[model samples]
Target: MISKSKVTAKLSVIDRFLPLWIFVAMGLGVALGRVYPAIGPALDAVKVGGVSLPIAIGLFWMMYPVLAKVRYGKLQSVSANGKLFGASLAFNWILGPILMFALAWLLLPDQPHYRTGLILIGLARCIAMVLIWNMLAKGSGEVAALLVALNSVFQILCYSVMGWFFITVVPTWLGAESTEFHVSMWEIAKSVLLFLGLPLVAGALTRVGFVRSRGEEWYEKKFLPKVGPAALLGLLYTIVLMFAMQGDKIVSLPFDVLRIALPLVLYFGIMFTSAFLLSKKLGFSYQETASLSFTAAGNNFELAIAVAIGLFGISSGEALAGVVGPLIEVPALLALVYLSLWLKDRLFPADVRANETAEPKDQATSLAQGGQLR
Candidate 1:
């Protein structure tokens, strides 16, 4: 029997208390912003190709380690997974974005800026943290890694076009008011390259190089553990800086945060539940169902935050909406992690559940010890 505590115990201290840390980081950022009115400007003064240097570093740091953990060597097998691939693409690119757009507008008809922010998040997709949620729930790591790689490619290619379409074209089609803001595809593409592309390349190179030189066993068991925790540190740093950048807005507009959170909560719940049920109906194993659920439920908040700050200014409502994303996601997904485990017992066959739990202890314990919960 996998007790709830046993399942959660695999997570590192950082992953276990991620929501608390994020809240603390938010409070700290808000306090820093309040203490130093000029902090935002001072940080913004230094730019690397138009992005603030500090923020760029934070984004790269947040993304690279998590990406590095991907098992790229197994990607060759992904070509055989026709049904899984088709289903994932449909859920992630099609259903995910449309659902968020509807929820954002339905929930926040008055707040266009925040609505736009949530829509941007939906289009971004989950390439980073879904691995953690998938792994902790005893999902198929290889499939999750493949999905992450697939999403990364699609993200680089489609995110800008999707952003333009949802933010500009859809609003016009509906005869609704679009914001005065205009973001060229080139502008968004540049942000995606700097924020998502570079780190992805670096992470891939790191994994390949290390595996070749030191062997896969050494890389996964030793190297991954050392670097895994850094991802959280980068996340906390970026959150604090983002909140500090818009501290005044966040502090004054506490209710706005709650308003933005409502659609997000609905989005996560709907996506995860639908994906789980759909995967089960399609006859995927518990591992695949859990992987699909997490992949469907999670969003690439780091990319959203970076793009929001770059295109819409650091203190813009879009950026605040981006910042509020993980605040709701961490708790929601953590609960889903437990829910996935619970469903494994009830919905899946004993034979399939037995196979998952029977995975070699060495590999499982290594991952848990290495703190792979990015």
Candidate 2:
């Protein structure tokens, strides 16, 4: 078994201060935008179906490593942790969108564009960054990986449908003004196919091909260790580019961050509490609970940002809301990581942790036949 302590011991400076890196990237982006006003409009012109090609390049890099590391084989093991998976599915898919709609309606009834933005954010689920969050929180990497794989695939399938229903259908159904434009499923699918679908298949192929060539041991111990951090670097670059593109918009709205943040903050806080309390009620161990809660609470803001820009123009309120997601999510999830560690000790206790340790391993095995060693 790969020693968990050894893995933790190898933490680099980059990993230690991911939050700082994210914010610094944001600040740098804003500075660049202010310094060079022409840069944003120039970059915005490069879009196919609302997805920026330049941003897509960086995002692909960010997504690939995370997907590459996911033991798609563990998908089979998902059933092994049916309770956790089931709860996560409900939280992420069904309840997540509904809650956001309600919250946005309550919080920003007059701000239609912002409401649509929050709704879009709710529809997208996190796949890449939660792996980092889970690892930081000392949660189950295997389960986390499994959830990422599952969520990634699920997002491609559900995002457009959920978005349409919530943004256009639900509002119209409830007798509110429909702010949704012509967001066809094909457009959504195309963006998802390019952004998420390709990375997933490529990652799987890379994993299987390399493991076959180099052996499973080499793939995990050598290959993964070398390539895994690329995902985070990709995320940082993408953030910089995103903010650089939207820095002026973000800066102009002096209190908009607070305004945009209000509903999202409530969303994160409540989603986490609901997930945490539900996990405990369902008799989950610390690791299982952590994985479940993180999966539910984390929004795949990368995909959200892409979809927003695609569906709503880059300068639209929808896109800006999508941009704000990472700003709020990075720090908030970090705090939750610490909170989860505390909860694990106080709530889960020793016996529970010991008993649940094997759960992810078993799941990992079913997914990859011989997934990454824990």
The Cα local distance difference test for each model comes to 0.78, 0.74
Residue-wise C-alpha lDDT for candidate 2, range 1-374, written one tens digit per residue: 33455533445656655668878988998888889998788877787546567787886887777677766676666559777878888998988888988998998888888888888888888765676667656566667767766786677677767777888887888899886645555765566577666777898899999988998899877787778777768878877887887788878986877788888888888888789888898887776788888888888776677777767777888888888887788778877877886777688777445644755443222111221223
Q: Using alpha carbons, what is the TM-score of model 2?
A: 0.82
Worst ten-residue run, lDDT, model 2? Answer: 363-372
Q: What's the lDDT for residue 220 in model 2? A: 79
Instruction: Give me the runs in candidate 2 sitting further than 4 Å from their true place.
Output: 1-10, 145-161, 172-175, 306-312, 351-374
TM-score, predicted candidate 1 vs. hidden true structure: 0.80
Per-model RMSD to reference: 3.8, 5.2
lDDT of 1 at 16: 69
